[model samples]
Target: MTETGESGGRKYDPAATHNFPDERLNAILPDLLSDPEITTYLEAQNVNAVTRKGYNDHGTKHVEIVRNRALNLYDLLKGGDVGFNGAIDQDLDEADEPVIIALAATLHDIGHVVHRDEHVYYSIPLAADLLDRLLPEFGFYDASEAVRMKAEVLHAILCHHTEEDPLTTEAGVIRVADALDMERGRSRIPYEKGGRGINTLSSQAIESVSLRPGDGSPVLVEIEMVNAAGVYQVDNLLKAKLDGSGLENHIRIVAVNTKAEDRLVERIEL
Candidate 1:
């Protein structure tokens, strides 16, 4: 499946996956691949059925998903005025920062290739190791800079699951983008090998997502869902995702399509 946004007709395929905006990534991939340990681990990630359902475990799909999703979120944030007011504006263009964000988002789920219980826990270390091993190849001054980048990437990758961690704008953007797609697709894929129905059943397709600024409190985001199934899914899973993505207290489900008639039901916020 291709990920395309309304703004740019750009779609990423595995065919030419390395057209990075920054050249720093070019220097890094070779070193990353040079380490047989990482290669071996990444290679063995496909044996599990659950891993097969995710975007990036064993194939190029995950990377493409990450890149497209990350870019899409950036676009949305900029459109929503969040970029100008948020840290993304400050850090997006810093040398290789976009690549760092894109790469982390792309690689964050590799641990799921092993186990789902704590994918973040495993993926972060792997990312750090890969970055360190590839530092020389990437032409970093020394292992120190590589380690710093690794730390930053790890911060973004690991914290994508929860907001408690130090959130760089790139990380926050990746987390939200990674999550928004759960409703767009992948919900029909079975979560377990022997799962009966759609393992990742979707709650709804969001018709709109809007944010309201507050005086002293946190930002408020209102989400509108497409159907009752969407409602069920949001209440059960997506809400947690919102909270985890650092929008829990800030985001609210304002309306839904209850009749399945594809007509939006509006609720007044009191």
Candidate 2:
């Protein structure tokens, strides 16, 4: 269960269950990671999925993974001079980009409380109310600024699904980040209970996914699989999520088989 990567010449555990480290995040949104409302909502979402829907883990763990990965993509692209939709247009401050991305990534799946299909649209209002209450606690007391931030966060949540196009850099990052939560542990619960089909099998084949700086691109998404069949998760699920995302040009995805001497399975770049 150990996954590793390097950033700024330092080693980090990608599979670690703790919050991702970011100094700016601590200054701007110090209360978000431990917010009671967010924690309660995530717990309820997991109960709904496991008790009623028979789905895999889409709770706090999934959201945290998305949050970390989305922020990683955002920072990499921003460092490489990629312009964010809100920042480039003067709608959101550059410093606020990570906050919005993290909020959107963390709350995107809360709508499963209502239903699974079209949960993206349902998530908008749910996340908006939560943001309205939570933003001011973090010093976003200005009315107009809070309203604008809420709108942007909702947009990112709505666009995390493939049916919707992510118009902003943050939203695009959230979309791809959501898809990267395909490690086998994510589906182990349902798979062991006789979960069948491509979704479960593809997830089971994924051994690990790592995000790091790339040589040719701004970010590299390296996926290691126990079987070549895991390519279905990358090609069908992850690729669909990244195709319409605005961050595609800044990313390069490579999948390899760990059981096959690290043989290259699939490589995609746009």
What number of clashing residue pairs does each candidate have, in the order they appear? 4, 0
Q: Write the per-residue lDDT of candidate 2 for residues 10-65, one digit (tens) a residue.
A: 12233433332345455654488778889998888877676677788888778777
Candidate whose TM-score is highest:
2
Question: Please, what are the lDDT tens digits per residue for candidate 1 over residues 14-69?
Answer: 34333234355445544544557654655565445345444213333444445565
Model 2's C-alpha root-mean-square deviation from the true structure amounts to 4.8
lDDT of each: 0.50, 0.76
Model 1: number of backbone collisions: 4
Segments of candidate 1 deviating more than 4 angstroms: 1-46, 49-63, 75-93, 140-142, 163-166, 183-185, 191-199, 203-226, 233-236, 244-270
The lDDT, on a scale of 0 to 1, for candidate 2 is: 0.76
lDDT for model 1, on a 0 to 1 scale?
0.50
